[model samples]
Target chain A: MVLSERDNHLIAEIQDGLPLSSRPYREIGRRLGLSELQVIERISALQDGGVIKRMGIVVRHHELGYTANAMVVWDVPDDQVDSVGEKLGSQPCVTLCYQRPRKLPEWPYNLFCMIHGRERERVLEHIDSIVASQGLEQLPRKILFSGKRFKQRGAKYR
Target chain B: MDDTDRAIINRLQESFPITDRPYLQAARELGIEEDELIRRLQSMLESKLLSRFGPMYHAERLGGGLSLCAMRVPQHEFERVNEQVNVFPEVAHNYARDHEFNMWFVLATETPERIGSVIREIEQLTGCRVYNMPKEEEFFVGLKLEV
Candidate 1:
């Protein structure tokens, strides 16, 4: 969606996160030369239009004791990818799931899902349960546990 | 984190009201004082338990692009390549994973076409081939980590 100049400014203002104040939107509007009502209305409209996927506290899983998160990659057949992906995505444990391209002989896994848990054992158990219930035991897969998070932050447009 | 903190995290992760006094409204719902709610949030931020608290914009819908790119950097050259690749503001999140493709990072650009240009620049700067893996499709998953 093409955003207006003012809307772009609004996004830039809140990119870091909303202000911690009684009148957070009012503070934002003051910076953008807009009224509190206008700021709130614009944000509400953007959210209602699905431009804002979510608006709330973004947790750092590791800090909250969810240290183990593995990127589980699956090599599902071409025709069966969508079904498998949908089924995998439906699981509550799979925080993020996507169908990315395989990089030939070096990388042959196309389907990817990220499962997070406080413990490695529980995370693996969850994966095992999913595979058994979904009848995906035959699929070849690899689990790459994340290490050394160099950087993590919300996207910046400005 | 205490019980109160956990409750706040779980509740706030689902939604945060946008209002003249959002904190007050949320505090009432969570059965806590507004000042206490704000205080806990502030402490959490300082302690790094809460990475951020705000809107998550859909960059694609806003004409931006996002891709997960990986490079198999030799162990000796990993540090140099990491600093070089991270200089670009477009590289949002970078991680070292256990795999043949050892380095994985997310690129979020202001424009969709910028994704390719950034990838080209990274490859040139690091002298490593980047496996550009842009998502062809994303399955809908509303549920997130409860904690």
Candidate 2:
């Protein structure tokens, strides 16, 4: 979508995250010389255009008692990937799931899902359940848990 | 997935108040009663659409070890390798980014050494090389989906 100067500015401002205030949009509008309604309308338009994804909280799972988190990758057959991925992604425990290209002789997993829990064993149990249910007994998979947390943030589409 | 859900998501994306009664404050800001806000939030949590609604801490300030790692698994062994790698508690979001180094995952650990050890264990289990690419410089990619 064509982003006007004002729209670009608005996107940049909110990209840093909205201020923690009673009237955040108003505050932002004041800075941009636009009314709160105007700001909201612009954001809604951007969202409708698919320029902005979802506006939601970005929590620290570890701090919130989900001490254990892991990324699980699956090698499902090409034809069944969509059905399998949809089921896997819909799970409550699965946080992030998407399809990415596999590099031959290097990377091979086509489907990826992230599962988090309070304990390591709990996370594994969930993964095992998913693998078995999906009838992926023949497909190979791997789980890479975090050894450290360096940085994490929502995307900035300025 | 509808208009109401989109509106609620937009509201949640913005930070909630930091006051003693944050929920009450949020309710006032949203022009809704405290109880209503609480009810909606509970419902949102019940729905997987809202992954979480809470604090986004600065891990570096707290001295946490974080890095992005990738593995090269042969097509035949991807599922097995995925299971072994995910067993670790420290793994966070894993993406199948389109790259030669496929299978990208994030590790948030308490120490840097632990990051190495975890990679080592994955390498042994998957029988593949683990590329530990820790970020030398941080790039902030603010990706918010307009639900």
Candidate 3:
């Protein structure tokens, strides 16, 4: 998508995240020499166009007591992946769920879902229930518990 | 955290109004002054309770490509391989995992084709196999870890 000069500038400024102020739009407009309404309008249009996925807070789950995080990968049949992905994604405990291509001989898992909790045991238990209820016991799977976070930040296009 | 702090975290996570006086509106909804709301948010950010507060952009929609890539590095060489992988500007999120595919990261590229080349380059540089797992289908799951 080719963004106009103005829109590009606005995205560059706001990509770090919105300002933490009562009138954040106003502050952003002040910096860009735009009216608060214009800022809001541009953001709304961007979102409507799918350029901006969402406008929300990015919380640190660990600090919020969600220390246990596991990325569960499943090797379900190709035809059934869509249905299985939808079912797993619908689970409240699943933070992320998607379908990825299986790398041939070495790697076979195609469906991926992430679950987060305050404890490792709790996360495991949740995964167990998901596997049982979702009828995924027969599928080959692996649970990779996340270790240290080397880097995590918003995507920077500019 | 106190009730007010918890309230701010809970409310802000779901949605932040897009308005001329967004903070004021949020404060009104939270039953607090605008300045106090902003102050609390700033403090929380400073204390690292919130990693970031802003608009989340969909990279693929914005003419970029993103994928989840993993590597299986020898335990002794994990740190060395990690440094090599992190040096790439496209690497967004990197994490160590306790599996054969020990190192995992997200690569955000300027173009979709760049994903393959990036993986190839990393494989050569790190001397390890790079598994590029680009999402073929995404299910919408509004992930809100309730505090």
**CA lDDT, every model vs. true structure:** 0.90, 0.64, 0.88
lDDT of 3 by residue, A36-141 (tens): 8999999888988879877777888888888789999999899999899999999998988999999988889999998999999999999999989988899999
Predicted structure with the largest DockQ when compared to the true one: 3
Per-residue accuracy of model 1 over B8-39 as CA lDDT, tens digit each: 99899878887778899999999999999989
Candidate 3 lDDT tens digits, B24-125: 888898999999988888888888888888877888887789999998899999999999999998899899999988999999998899999999999999
Residue-by-residue lDDT tens digits, candidate 2, A90-136: 67677667666565555577776767788889989988887788676
Question: Interface RMSD for each candidate model?
Answer: 1.5, 11.4, 1.4
Q: Give the residue spans of candidate 3 off by over 4 A.
A: none
Q: Candidate 1 versus the native: TM-score?
A: 0.96
* Residue pairs in collision within model 1: A1-B61
Predicted candidate 1 versus true structure: per-residue lDDT over A1-158, tens digit per residue: 55799988898889888888888999999999999999989998888887888788889988988899899999989999999999999998898889999999999999999999988899999999999999999999999998999988778876
Instruction: Provide a comma-separated list of chain B TM-scores, one per candidate.
Output: 0.94, 0.86, 0.94
lDDT agreement of model 3 with the native: 0.88
Off by over 4 Å in 2: B1-147
Q: Report how closely model 1 matches the true complex, as a DockQ value.
A: 0.77
Order the candidate numbers by lDDT, best to worst: 1, 3, 2
